[model samples]
Target: MNSNRLPLFTRADNFVKDLTLTSNQLLLIVCAYIALILNLPFLFKSANAITGLDDFNWLFLITFPIFLFSITLLIQSLFAVKWLIKPILIITVIISTLMFYATLTYGIVFDYGMVQNTVESDSAELLSYLNLYAVVFFIVFAVIPAVLICSIKISYQPFLKELFNRITLFAGATLITVLIGTIFYSNYASVGRNNKDLIDYITPYKGIDSIYKFARKHYFYPPLKFQLLDTSPQIINKNNNKHVTVFVLGETARAQNFSLNGYNRLTNRYTANQDVISFTNISSCGTATAVSVPCMFSRLNKSNYDKRLATSQQNVIDIVHLAGTDVLWISNNNGSCKGVCTRVNTQQIATTKSNPLCDGEYCYDEALLQPLREKLHKLEYDNTLIVLHMIGSHGPTYFKRYPSNKILFTPDCQRSDIQNCTQEQLVNSYDNSIAYTDYVLNQIIIELSRLSETEDVASSMLYVSDHGESLGEKGMYLHGLPYAFAPQEQTHVPMIFWASAQVSNSTPDIDLTCLKNKSTNVFSHDMVFDAVLSITSVKSKTHHIKNDPFYGCKSASFVPLPLLESAKKIQTQSSGEH
Candidate 1:
């Protein structure tokens, strides 16, 4: 190998053979390549976010790129070993290309929560995110560069010389970072503190950081034993009639889109006259199903919600099962339950290809109803709690969520790359999905009502979404941004409840009028644990009256809207805010 250029054979052996590069040169090239090409989304976002002005400005032009490049250079210098740099750079580029596509298209960040979601997602979910556009993007951005990188055969310096060069390079990079940072302290401080997610936008590095964080927590950390929260919970309002409660866990259905929450369209037409109380102002624990589903079921509130901690401890499902209520989880949303249903009986309908409503890829929410009816007919326990996890409006393929005949909205986007579609088309598809979810929920309500009348069971139902989604609002798409800086479109979700005449309006029996009066009042997933316990009549030590929203809305008396807002304001102002 010549010092200026060397011919090293590649597996394919197609590219220019002679590559004149040293390990130090390769390191600099890799760092520069990632900082400039792979970090375009991050750089562009930072540029826009930093500049309050409409046009491109000078301060941001000078400050961010140099600082970010210096940081990348320093990080790359740490791994500048002769044999290690190529593979490392190749891997970084490949993974970051996908991340870059996601961030540029949907404004997603590879935060810890997103990493967890990615690792937990099933094949169907994974395939949904892939398309021709994504393939082309990856090929242009990742594969070609990786192939070129693989072809590079570098010259090496003497061991002592290499070590000294690396030390000097590292020191120089560090000094450059410090100097630029000091020069742009005000600009950096303003953006960094106000936009904590600015750090998350750093491509490949943030993705790498998230992967390490998730792995360390899941694999390397000390595992905690499965906690049994309440083996013997207090069952209230025991009566001759059986207690049947259906908790429908919704997926990605936001409150603002539902007609029940004053959407201009009748997206919630099916449930409009079903005598259900829609909770208008409801916040989710997290912006993704992986976090929200488990967190809602767990004893932890959103403020203290940790996936590992929440999963290790027994959730509401476990408590419900222990209270002698036969617990059944009917899942149409694969991977959305996030192990919350592992302790209980579960039936998968996500890929029930035999079902007419379902293809091999996914099933409609109606797939849950038949099994539920069968379970109702063959009821073994008087007190039963059934969780129907619906794949409601989950995107970027919302068009596939419902059957063709159920498509109430026209001009719906049929493609997976929703960014290519008009806002109207995208929303039409999403609205149809939401409407279909409501139709399914209405079916459940009707079935439960019939059971209450014919089989003499005290029945009720609650449908609450795991999280909301952004429909191109403020140049964002989908959910699973970091919760700290996530928009309301990804955090505020829909929650609704319905009770049959069999459920008397009294203590332990929630009053509809009272619940309606507090419909506009604020609530969060923090209240779901105790609310579920209360609804299922499973009263454990953790099921406090303060945490059960229904328990407070037992009276049929109505509070004025002004008073409700004032109360909400007070509640939000003080401690223990959601």
Candidate 2:
């Protein structure tokens, strides 16, 4: 806080000039400020959730801050040293303040899932969160307080005495928190049990815990050797006709908003008349791309998913590639594939040669269509898998997802501060993005259809969103709530399947009518692995018939004797472990 350099902050510097406090005192004050002021989102949400049937429980409201203050104080006391106190305090307060902006503005929960998404977000994606409101909040809460912290002089005692004092502070804070919890046991217990997500709203501590967990998984844990589910996957029922399937990994497209799935709006206008059928009931593996994208591609299910283990293994793409299929990933998404595309050949659109469709920061979903059209002509393999990873409906700039000329909905919200927009305007913008997605998909389908008819190749497409979005529902906006407390808006994603006549005529298992009838049945991202394997005719023990929606209608003649023998051998070999 050099007054000469930052002259505007001179008053702030002068205000704290005479303040000389012991390290313990400074720690307590910063902790208190952080717990109360920086935790407005936490307290407000908790109050809303636990106000009961009446106005409020005044006693519980008072005790909640005391609990938060005690928790923060105890955490800070452990790091209370003359040389370290102010630095640690400043860092924590600054991060807490930023987290405050996100939680307060978008109702985001700083759980491990969201921490993954935040860390992996690219510069452009990160910048979308910035606006005038965020800047003002940062200046008033973070910068000003940080300057004051640096300006205030910390008093020192003898080293041993300072250590003893810090120890006492730690003990006192811990005892007070424990005593408060014990006294308000019934109130705290009931509220917490009913509202489990309240734990994630404990200011920046929840975020700190998530970061620590992420670091521990990526750093502290021993390096894991890359493992494959099966190394001997084979393309079964091989034929002369080439097979092409476009696996469209969608972003933030919930099923509820899709007209194909009964939404009132014509969001799926292009696909409505196309041969595609939308899966009406399907949930995502996780609420954010960082978590969902990886899990959706891996040999992992939501119940047994482990981030470290998933990253250190061959995903569905690798298995398909290994089965002698030429696989390529084209991402219009800035949030790279979260390690899912590491082993596959990938092309990032935003980094390529200049295009009129791309505006430096973002490109419309149509930007994906031209390359897709060009690639369909260059096919040199019998079985081909092209993944079009779309940046669909990612906010808080939904208006940027599609072009102005393509805007199908009126009075769309065009600003990043979506909270300030009317609900109708916000929803209109989101629906327009959905309609644009249909147009892009329709273009890709037309290209695939041409290839199928002209080149006699079997063409098909499968589209599934990584997760869903929340458009100011239940006073919550955006996505990434903890999965346990996540609303359906963040999990019930759209999955659509479209196959040219060649796919059904060539691929034995793909009974389109049967699959469409089963579309209304419950399914999840776990089914993605098997569905892809079945569509591409890749056979391995890992491709469970039970998980594939097309398998019931699969012809028994398609199963080869050697594949059956291999399955038995693998099962017999691994049966001892269980």
Candidate 3:
């Protein structure tokens, strides 16, 4: 800042040299800075939570220089006439926007998973971009430069000279600001108490695409080596021995919400009436359908799933197809993202179904089962593995999952946003969908039973959800909260099996009766591989028959599967064992 010598100390020189500021402008600048500081937490918290939680410190730690430099530039404009103000303001806007954009890009690269975790799992990118835009607008437009304009100091020089001076001021100010920030940060930092742990927890070790590829390759969570079970049930009394097994893969069905799993409503009455066995304490490896479906099907464990060193080998479905058992994937999901059924045949028309509860909309779970009867009629095979992916209990549109006629409980939640509704209404809508899913499963079983009567075939049905959903508990809506932070509602899913009397009694050597009375101690979506392989008699290298962690671990602890127990342990430890 330079002062020009006044011409003989006249009144005109006084007007030129003396800097003046209105009270309102000063107040506005102070208010803007205060608002920026206050709003910084919410803005940076989400980004940092995604990239690394330590980001909150930068708000106070380094913000001073950014504020000072912007204000310095702003104050310099005071010497310019009203004619030059518009150009100066435009330049300031451009520079601030570019800086904010750069900061957000850096934040996102380190913390994409947090973005993935915060956004609704379906529309993550949109949420991330929107969040960045909001943060940038506040800092650039309302915060920094506003403070500078409030101070009544001004100067004017050639454009090049001004640019050089501005650069010098920015460099000096930034260096000093950072040094002060380091001191402030050191004062506030604490061992394991600050954002350090949060930063580590959310930081992505690998790119998201790499993570996806890794998940698809490993397919198993906490992957253990291929250990085939030692025992196999002998089919000695072989009368009408042709066998047919159906594996129904349900979508987003939480076991806790299922009436069969002890919810108040009769959500699964149809299966309860039949010779169905419900395994209540089952958990999915991952929460998202994309991650969980293929992961459950893969031989790779969860820890090693994303590890570059993990082996890439044949999945359970591939083994089934190789064993000459007809394998069919009938899905309502968007093909599981990885296209786990890419090599295998899949039937999915549910995408086109209109919502029965609303006009011109697709909602009924039964829409997936529409073509099943026709497909089965065409098949001539004696042994078959039909995987039905049910669109069960996916929300915030829980009310649209089932038909209006199927709303068995009174005072139904007509709206999709269950968070705003009464808990009872939410339960009623959710349970009604489960009731409809139960009906669909029962109908498929009845068809299998009819086939068993007419043809020389053994029939059975096994149902497992990819993962569970969460209702409005602890201020969370829908599902797909980060698995570590996720409630039991999202992880604990329902697994059930229906076997005909002939097959049940003949295979009485494998006692499911104990499983019926007590929820199986060894239960997981991982066990689906062993269960299906066991059911189809595909005693191959990929199958596990005995000492299986699939269910019924001979341990004192009531926990069904060791994987679930371990995940719970990991989560507990990370949360300081709270």
lDDT of 3 by residue, 1-578 (tens): 23355465454445534655433233234333432432233235534443343444545534533443344434433433434543444344443343233233222221223333333243422232344345656566544454445334444556677656545654654565466546655433442244343332221222234356545644655543532221222222234366777888888888887777788767888877887878887888776665577767765545434322212345667777766767788765443424457668877654432544323334365665556777667666656778887667776566767776777886877764355578778777777778888999989888888877776457778888888776666544555545655678778988887777556544322345755665556567666766666666554444433324323522222222443444344323323311
Q: Name the runs in model 2 displaced over 4 angstroms.
A: 1-13, 48-50, 53-58, 160-168, 351-353, 507-509, 559-578
Q: After superposition, how far is residue 55 of candidate 1 from its true place, in Å?
A: 16
**Clash totals in order:** 2, 0, 24
Q: How many backbone clashes does candidate 1 have?
A: 2
Instruction: Name the 10 consecutive residues with the lowest summed lDDT in model 2.
Output: 569-578
CA lDDT, candidate 1, residue 71 = 91
After superposition, the stretches of candidate 3 with alpha carbons farther than 4 Å from their true spots are 1-240, 307-312, 335-337, 350-363, 416-418, 505-509, 544-578
TM-score of each: 0.91, 0.92, 0.63
Most accurate candidate by TM-score: 2
Estimate the TM-score for candidate 2.
Answer: 0.92
Candidate 2, backbone clash total: 0
Q: Cα lDDT of all candidates, in order?
A: 0.83, 0.85, 0.56
- What tens digits encode model 2's per-residue C-alpha lDDT throughout 1-578? 55567665666556589789888888878888998899988888787776872435677777888888999898888776567778888999899988898888888978888888888899999899888888898999999889888989988999899888888888898898999898778777788777888889888989999999998887788877776669888887546678898999999998999999999999998988897888999999999999899998877778778778777777889999999999999999988888988888998887443877887888888888878887899998888999999999999899999888999889999899899999999999999998999888988888998998898888999999999999999878999999998999999999999999887777464778888889899999989988898888888767655566767756555554455455445434333221
lDDT of each residue in 85-121, candidate 1, tens digit only: 8888888788888888999989999999999988988
Comparing 1 with 2 on TM-score, the higher-scoring candidate is: 2
RMSD of each: 5.4, 3.7, 11.9
Task: Give residue 445's error in model 2 in angstroms.
Answer: 0.8
Candidates ranked by TM-score: 2, 1, 3
